[model samples]
Target: MKTEKRKLAIWMTMEAIEVIGLKRIVLDRDVAEAVGFFHAVIAPQVFATAERFGIHRVDVEETEDGRLPG
Candidate 1:
């Protein structure tokens, strides 16, 4: 569960760069805070809620270069 949340937080943080417009906009402090909170807080809640919906997957599939697959 801890590992899964950490992994999900990485993916979520990357997505946040675009969704939250954090690319060079917000300070590194914001990124740090967001990542930590996502992993420690949001990720757990997400997984708990997901189980109710039959969703158990937490890993993200990516290419060798770390890019999201199409």
Candidate 2:
């Protein structure tokens, strides 16, 4: 089996207390299938719960090499 690169953008921010708000999750075309599979196989409830109680935060970009911006 071969694993493909998944570029996922997750929005996150500090919620009041005891909970971190997980906003919207944008999965690129490469990772859209993976994201669906993950939710279906691993944790289906996560998507629902995230939508219910999470606030949409800022957008984050993902790079393959994981290099810091200079």
Candidate 3:
């Protein structure tokens, strides 16, 4: 028997206060790496907004293709 490898991608959406509004980001990485990237790169800024402009929501989706349907 043979197996095939598949590519994975991560889609993230964040809603912040009035200033930031809504932001969407995409990463071509596996779930673990994508989460790590978010913690390392995006989380700090998001946490900073927690005082006044808190984050409304954060969504993470995994897809074979790094894109949403048109």
Give the candidate number with the greatest TM-score: 1
For model 2, the run of ten residues with the poorest summed lDDT = 18-27
CA deviation > 4 Å runs, candidate 1: 1-29, 59-70
Residues 1-70, model 2: lDDT tens digits: 9999865444543335313111232233446654554434333343444457673422224535533222
For each candidate in turn, the TM-score is 0.41, 0.21, 0.33
- How good is model 2 by TM-score? 0.21
Candidate 1 per-residue lDDT, tens place, 1-70, comes to: 4555423322223445454544443455576666655555556666666676676545434337532233
- Writing each residue's lDDT as its tens digit, candidate 3 over 1-70 gives 8988754334435445411321222333356655565665566555455434543434234435633222
Residue 25 in model 2: shift from native, Å? 27
Clashing pairs in 3: none
Error of 1 at 40 (Å): 0.6
Q: Which ten residues in a row have the lowest lDDT in candidate 3?
A: 18-27
Local distance difference test, each candidate: 0.51, 0.40, 0.45
Supply the global lDDT for candidate 1.
Answer: 0.51
